[model samples]
Target: MEGKSWIFKNRPAIVASGVVGGPFEQKSPYSGEFDLVKDTLWMEEESFEKANRQLIESAIQVTLDKKTLSSNDIDALLMGDLINQITPTSMAARTLSAPYLGLFSACATSMEGLALSAALIDGGYCQKVLTGASSHNAAVEKQFRYPTEYGGQKPPTAQWTVTGAGVALIEKASPHNAPLALIEKATIGKVVDNGIKDPFNMGAAMAPAAADVIERHLNQTNQTIDDFDLIITGDLSRIGHPITEDLLKQKGIAFKSGQFLDCGKMFYPELPDVQAGASGPACSAMLVYSHFLNELQKGSVRKILSVATGALLSPLTFQQGESIPCIAHAVELSSPAVNSQSFRGEE
Candidate 1:
């Protein structure tokens, strides 16, 4: 790894992915891409948190079923969620037979898991890894803010938590399995805080971190925005999307028209009551693993840079009057059709 970035020479491949969403997500324009859609958020479970865990389990099971593999075939499991201590993800991992590693980066946990999965395979330490992130609307809201029954008024900056889970099976590159996308590079982010204390304004809190990592990733890799067919941010939503664009512009970095977008903003463009749009760990995960992966497979986009951002503020921290610290993790992905000439690193 060189300066917070890892250029994978072997190019780990995301062979298969699974996305499970709640009934609310059924209205999303990309709902057709989901592997499974539960008719209710309860998911036949007793509590919302249990339902949250079920989402992760269902997503992982779907991914395994797609490849006709089982837990015995998985080398490791890296998963996370937005619940306190990420209990939902840990509880779900308990049911899995493979070695498990729980991760947390607020909304950015998805890319964090993917980056580590690619690193493990690229370093020849593991053959196959299950990595994912999940978020539940009710469970996260109850923990992070007021309960759904509170009837509290929210500002337009507030983003709705996505009720979904996205899991992927990443493995060593191979000739037999034509993977969806290849992981070429990953740029880990540094924490950035601008003294933003309102949890409802997560987009504003995370925007700077996203821009910082993007600039660093391009500089360290000697690449430009033109190198990628698309550059997508995790859950910046409508508010942070423009802020990020302006920040990049001030830094003298410009993107081609239609070259940049935010998964949060696009996740539920038409859904009502989604004030700023979607914001959660699953926001980016669901979009990338489902719609964007299909785009790569269909050759619609040859290369993509995904930057997943996170606002690292707990309820306790907020209650104690601490500012929200934010981070963003970037992963470079390309269609398998792209040749080795596009990959960088010491081979």
Candidate 2:
């Protein structure tokens, strides 16, 4: 039953989350937010690929350790990464030897995993699910653009691919303990292409897609911008963030600036050389799990509409002059105390 969204009747609980960041992220103002910060992006691995595996696997371990449960206790592991064929995520899964599902929606993989994780539990497929995403800046640069060894000059519109990984454990909501937040609903996004061929200008390319999903979610749920405490957008960076607001305004759905924020812009906004800001699956995943979840725990926020956006483009596609198609997935997390009307009142 898809309304404006998929409302999980079981209300999957975010039992625990773990985040890890690279050296640049550790020095940023948001440094202290994550569970672990590596001094080197390489993490003592022979290659960036191996390092990415370490980052993601370590994050899952951190969350599992918090629950005193190993991979053996997990019903399934849903993971994704930016690499081609999602190699790092696959390697991490192999180490754990848990049932695995590989996913990719560019940078939107984090929320995609979370949304599916909720569905798995809500559908009685499992009692618990582990979901998350990872990305390595050096590795992505090699795949989509000039390698780090090239020292290529980047334009202001280019976003820095974040070197990080974030993981989360979600289970059925229970009375034994208050969850970090409840997964109430998710709005799947459609592919939106506006003939944008420049990979550097992803922010502009992705804004329309984010606006579309947000609008559909609000209209479908019979709710307004007034409902969520925060409307979080994934990886729209500085340039795309305002475009999203403008597009929404054109749709006659205006959102307050204070209430709307983007994970890409928030992650490393003021940092020099970060270009447009951070973009990667880990950008929104880390900011949401490591930072915003803490705020939810402290009673600073009761609910959030997290929309993770992704620009669907490959090196070959760009070379072939195809426009970048984009997508956005929104996940609504509400505190049990102020569950409010953000959820479906009748089912």
Candidate 3:
């Protein structure tokens, strides 16, 4: 990996994906994008944590079912969540029982998992890998701050963590099975700390990191923003979206974020309670696995970059008065029919 970026020659194919969303997600514009939607946030589980595990597990099961494959067919499973020690994800992964690798990147875990999965397949280490991310609003709120029952007043900048799970099975290109999207390249980001200690204002803390990775990805690929049909950032919410746009312009990469989609903003624009927009690991996972991949299949989009951002802060760290360190990972996704020449266009 040259300076946290790798260009894949083996271009693995995302064969199938599954998404599960909570009741609030059902209210979102793209609710129909999910394969399974729960009528309630609890998902009929006793505790919110158990329900979170159910979300991730449901996604894995559905994805496997769609492909008519089982854990035996999957070489490995990589997944992550925002909960402490990724407890929910670990609990869910046990059911898969494949050679599992659990990841922790706060929210950027989805792209982190995707980048690694592509590398594994491209490097000839595995034929197929299933990877994804999950996050629950209640679980996150209770762990990171106050419980939802506490009824704490969140600031306008605070974002609602998405309650959902999304998983995808990626494998080498085959003659019979057409892939949803092709993994072109990836740029891994470094930790960025802007000294913003407020955990509620995650957007401000993560905006710089998102811009940094976008710049690095474009530079490494020798391309510009316009080269891709869309540049998406995960869970930036309302506050961080414009700030990231402004940061990119300041770096001399002139563009408008309106041309791109922020998962947080698009998830539930009609829900007034989502002050900024949706967030957490599940936000980007759900959007990509459903909306963008569906569009790519329909030929509505040719090429897109999925950049999932994360705030690397723990409840203890925040309470101890440490600044929020953040990261972002970008993965290039494109329709198999799209000409790769566009990726070679610029300096």
Q: Among these predicted structures, which one has the highest lDDT?
A: 1
Runs in model 1 lying further than 4 Å from the true structure = 340-347
| Per-residue alpha-carbon lDDT of candidate 2 for residues 154-196, written as tens digits (9 for 90 to 100) | 8899999888888989988776645777888999998998888
Model 2 TM-score relative to the real fold? 0.96
Tell me the tens digit of each residue's lDDT in model 1 across 1-347. 54757988888889999999999999899999999999998999999999999999999999999999988999999989999888888888888878999999999999999999999998988988999999999998888888899978899999999999999999877766678899989999999998999998999989999999999999999999989999999999988888999999999889889999899999999876999999999999999999999998777889999999999999999999999999999999998765544233334
Residue lDDT tens for model 3, 1-347: 54757887867889899999988888888888899998887888999999999999999999999989988898988999988889898988788888989999988999999999999998889988999999999999998889999999988999999999999999876545677888889999899988899888999899999999999999888989988889999989889988998899999987754567799889999888988888999999999999999988676899899999999999889888899999999999988656453233221
Q: Name the 10 consecutive residues with the lowest summed lDDT in model 1.
A: 338-347
**Better by lDDT, candidate 3 or 1:** 1
Q: What TM-score does each of the candidates earn?
A: 0.97, 0.96, 0.96
Minimal lDDT window, size 10, model 3? 338-347
Q: Best by TM-score, which number?
A: 1
Clashing residue pairs found in predicted model 3: none
Shift in Å, residue 272, candidate 1? 3.1
